[model samples]
Target: MYLYKFNDPEKALDCFTAFISRFPESGNITLVYYLAYEAAGKAGKASQAETLKDELIRKFPDSDYAKGLQDPEYFKKVDSDLRTVDRMYAEAYELYQNVYYKEALARCEDILQQFPGSKMSSYVLFLRAMCIVNLQPADEARIALNEVLAAQPTKRIQTVVNGILASMDVGDKPVLYADAEMYDARYLKSVRNWTFDEEKHAENTEEDRENPYKVNKEEEYCVVILLPEDMKTMQVLHLQTRLTFLNAALKAEQKDEKGDYQVKKEDLWYKTTALQIEPFANYGEAAVYLNRVAVDKTLLKNFKGARYRIFAISKTNFSVLKRLKNAEQYVDFFVTNYFDDRGQGEIITGRQGAAAHLFKYEADEKHDFVLMVPYRQVNVKKMAELLHGIEPAFALEKETYDDRYEMVVVKNVGTQVQSMEYLQLVSRNKEIFDRLSGTSSYMFTITQSNLGILLENQNIEEYMKFFDDNYQRNQSGEVGVGDGDFVYAKSVAHKFVLFYPNTIDPFKLKTTFEEFNFAGLMVNNVKYDDEHDCMVVSGFRNKEEAMRYFQTAVDNRKLFRSLRNVDYRNFIISDSNFDTMCEKKEIEQYLQFFKKYYLE
Candidate 1:
């Protein structure tokens, strides 16, 4: 009974089967047979379960099991459908493993069609969604993910669904969070205008089959922007500048291509009153000049139609532009062609040209500073306030350009700071801090920092302490704790802790340690002790129980040595190795003994 309760189904099956044979005429025989059949089913011995079912029918025709078998209308239907579903699932699983996503999807679909209301329907749906994701169609993947979320998903399935959703761009327009800070570096520059070319390489071999459709090459452009001076304002300016440029370019090209420029009567002549009656001049030259101006405007607009992405080169210093605090407040402004009716203008920042041109100088190593002033349309004051809250060292100034008000960049000087320092300050000041507090925020911050401070200090103790503290904090919370957090904490410990047995080889140790089951095992630390020729494992709640179990293996020298020699160096053992060392019968007996006495 103890072994059965500990999930040693194989051992429990053997014990129950033997007991059933000895007490065939006993009143408890039926119950014992039922348990044995259940154990057999759990151990994947479907044939053995069927045999037990047959024996129960022959021995007790009037029993419940016998009755169930005699009139199994619902069960018969379920059994027949389940077999087909299982076959389909197996085929789909195999296809998925081989990376044949389209075939796997078709198999999963077939299962749904064949067994509409089967218990395996949910699993089939999950596999179908996975196939869609791997198929590289975001629209279909999002729909599939939505279906999975709507269904009652297992924890593992939910994890996979969430991961897929995280990587996808779903919904209408993307919402830019106030807390979302863009990465600023030259490396990010490549992201702008990033093109993906899917070249089909047809092969002669069957395995090298190509996609049926010719791959289309997609050219994606990212908009980049630079603010004149203050680092804080530039963050906002970069995005706004790109958007404004896109709008302006779109409008300009539309007017030029369609020949829709508005003509005003007053603007026909610059000085109509001063012009005396004169001989007709070559009106064709004036008309040609006017047409030339229209063509130029249209061309400029078309050039702006391409995608604009913003990235600030951190390595270059924009210190000079940081001194314009008294400039006009121009974070937000509107562009107007006040005189033209058909040639109407959309809102554009006056600083569009300047902002776009700054990219040319971003990679210049000689420059220490770059300052960008956004067009008159940007709200300089509001932008300044946001900057001040994020980095107190930055100053904002207002200025005028072409008689229009615009903000100027001032010094971002307060406390000592670096590129990542600014990012941390922004992340801390952002709205995310309100939701992620205490240990949650601490864990996230530490992970996001990527051990930057620890690496800077080269302090292993501090690094280990960080992991230890977070691990304890995570364990305290039942609802909020997540496997991802635990995994991250373990990774940090693995990287920093020197005392842990970092490597495992068959020849190195006389005894083998069982691989730590991530789900069931929680280790605080690994300490090495050269004096005792043993590792002092500590910080477990059930250390006594674990030690008692260890003593049993120590007592049986041959069995103990054999168990100890098992190399569980890698997290998961190979199937061939497991089969070679322990047969089903041997595993059952050992598990039964261990579960009955070794485990608490």
Candidate 2:
């Protein structure tokens, strides 16, 4: 009978009813009937659920299921409220996906409250923790992460938890001191499990306790000490001894917020100071010297001479020395020696050492050759090509000397060239000619002749004046070649033309030329040849003159009658509107046109 309920509840219900009818006095009959009814209801047959409820109440009034219906809390504890739990869990999951962390957290909490012993309790707790981590404070997140970690989750969940812990900077002890000697063989061996040759040490220590110095696993602390890597043997020994003393001092002086001696701060300071010294001597003298030389000039300049104590030295000390030279050469020399060789203890001070340093210093100070070019006078591609060809020389020379020179070619195109386009071309081709040759160290200045004048002056004000003067002069009169008393106007036509050829409507040609401020305009020729069967038009003065020339050809009709039919109205309208629109649109078109013609 129980097998019927386990496999097929509908069939089991009928079997239970038949058995009850045959053996009504059986004590287990009530229990069998109750299960049959409950299984039927679970299968979503409402009639079965009603029948089961009626039978359970009538025949099994004292059963657990019957009693659960009387008290709703009892139903929840016995897993009789599975539908409600599923609905709540679904809602919480949806909220989590939408980033409604607080809502998700509340819903998960509800599951635990309503169904304390439900199988879904573990999952609900995990979700609640994740939501709390995102929505609540750092302390809450820490608690949440720890709870999740302690759960002994599935492999996938464990992997995710490990990743989250790695990203988090929680429970980390700040490094208080670092001494070079502490990393040595003796000291390293002293720290349990920290062996120089792990394989060999493992064999030797296998019989002993794996980690003898193992302190409290939960107690977190860090010690920072200077390690001697490249000092003389004597210097290394001195630093090692100092580190040991500093370590002892730190252990003695360290304290927590409650004023209890937990970790020594003085020991850390002492270790840090010892690391800074080239050779450890008296602490008082070292402290004084460090205070004097470790002064940050960058901070001093930034704060307007605000006196501040030096805490650390950085690589930027080299750059500071170079900048100090710009103010006073002697100051540069003094600062460089104090920091570079004497302070760093990288080189001894003498005539030969001094000569070598000076040679290196002079090389770094060499200036790059800058070439300025007028946009109107030179093609950018051609100039770039020329510069790229010289790159080999610069590359070869850079290999030999510490000092290097560069060719900085500046094209003064104003707003004519798009900054992005210009930069793209320069960067793409810089490798071709960006080097120096032999021992010359001199990079060439290849630029427009006009820009040469501005570079020679090195006065920005003068360059601006020159630019304005040239533009005004060009606009005032047609640019022409001087020949005694006669000035022949030079053609200012774009070398690369854009318009379709042989469809030359004199009026349209004039409009296009005027829009670009061309030196000449187009005019139609009245005379035509019968054998050629075409009328001639010439670009001459302006739009009006060009239209008049076209009209002349049309009136005569002796040239080609077909030429008279060509529309010139569009051309005339385009010319009249050219100036107003030129500033806004034509410049962009000109750039595109130039790019297509030259750069493509």
Candidate 3:
């Protein structure tokens, strides 16, 4: 009865075979005799069906089952119904071949009901189970496969179903980190099940209990610290530790009416923590955040002049982001974007117009490069001329703020180049520089506020003559000196010196500058004084050659320190008040301060 309920006629036939053998002479076996014939027909055993039918008619001619077999018209209708079922099976197979699994499944269900006791019923049920594979979820479809298995399907069908079940296991998928969804590949690999055992689960529970913020299983944001591949593991570990501490210990200074937190520099418990290092909901937000950080030199000082990258995975399962492949892909973006931004910054900052010494640190191939047209109208002709040496590839721009800002995507032309400095070296055309710099020192902005007047249209000699008069008039006031050029008092030096305070590690500072590839400056000597606790870096170069450059550095420092409440000068390696000490030839002043710690 159970076998018949589940449509397992083949298994029911096996039961009858056992019963007939055990009770060969039982008088009440007439019901079993008729059922055996019907079961054999349903199980697709034609020879067994014919034999059962013959026995029923020859031995029990007076029985109702034998009388039904005597009707020729009934047999003819059965044969016609078999042909119609065969056609339906063909159509279902055709639909399955075309990937129309839903329609194929519907047709299979119809055939199963219309020909419930047909000889081809088992084969049709098998088709229905396989079709469900494409149309239904793995667990739900497995139920249909189990039904087919109950009916004693062919060995070939059983093998295919077993293979599918093996593939459905969750352990077979790849694992990734929680933050990987920010990139193009939202999910990559599967995270390992670390808490699969009771002991491990207990350990995780204890760790969570000790943690400051309760771990929310519903959703979490995983913060991952990004750094250069060549960076020391100890440095990375140190940064990760500090970042974790800051996230837990720090609170915002104030919240706006809308509840957005305004985190000021003083509100931070850790002074070295980056203010720009906020949580990002997606890659788009991360990209903008990074670009803003790259542009703002003050933000770089927030980390005490340490170079680092940080990214966030917004509102996702940590297990989903732990895939190794996703971690690789996310890190690859840092490498690619770094070089891209470097190239762009060179053009945007107008570094080409100034002498090399003014730049405290140079850019290497690894530095972030990017070209940005500030959210305003720009002269297309001047922009084209600035990029004269390099080939311009078509950039796909993402429109932001109602098309006020066009975020041009990095292309092969920008990233494929060796380095931003390499481009400056090879493509720095003196003629182009003279033409543009003579008009307006600011390369990205317009000289005049007229819509039709482009920078290229202005006369170079007249513009400079006009600019000089205005520059001298306001030299002591608000207006900046054009091209960041400066004239300083003459000095005697057969060498150059770069001094840094004890706030940051000198070795790390050296590495950071080495990565920048500062244009004219080279590390000639490094002296670490234990007594003063300061590092003095001296470069062997004729000061006469780099006088104009260092003069610009001095002037920029004076301007930077003049800004109200600007404490960045104390920590920053470049353009710091240390330069003011250096300007006064006060090497002893720094050495004297360090002596308080060491010599005392």
Number of the top lDDT candidate: 3
lDDT of 2 at 232: 29
What is residue 16's positional error in candidate 3, in angstroms? Answer: 22
How would the candidate models be sorted by lDDT, starting from the highest?
3, 1, 2
TM-score for each predicted model, relative to the true structure = 0.20, 0.18, 0.20
lDDT of each: 0.38, 0.38, 0.42
Candidate 3 residue lDDT tens string, 1-600: 423445777887876666567866644244456677778989999899788888878888875457667874654565477668877977776555434566778999999888886656767777887777655666667788788877775555567666766666643322221223322121111111111234656876786454222223224233343343233322333343333223222322224322111221111110112222444444454444334334343222233322344443344422333322243343333343433665343322222211111122221212221233334444434545445334444332222312333222223222212333323332244443344332312322111121012122332232222222322222332221111222111121222334444444434434333322233344322333432223222242323444444455445544233233422222112222234444555555544443332123
Candidate 1 C-alpha error for residue 250, in Å: 79
Candidate 3 regions with alpha-carbon error over 4 angstroms: 1-70, 169-600
Per-residue lDDT tens digits for candidate 1, residues 74-114, read: 44555566666766787787566544567788999888887
Better of 2 and 3 by TM-score: 3
Displacement of residue 46 (Cα, Å) in model 2 is 34
Question: Least accurate stretch of 10 residues (summed lDDT) in model 1?
Answer: 267-276
Report the C-alpha displacement of residue 58, candidate 3, in angstroms.
Answer: 11
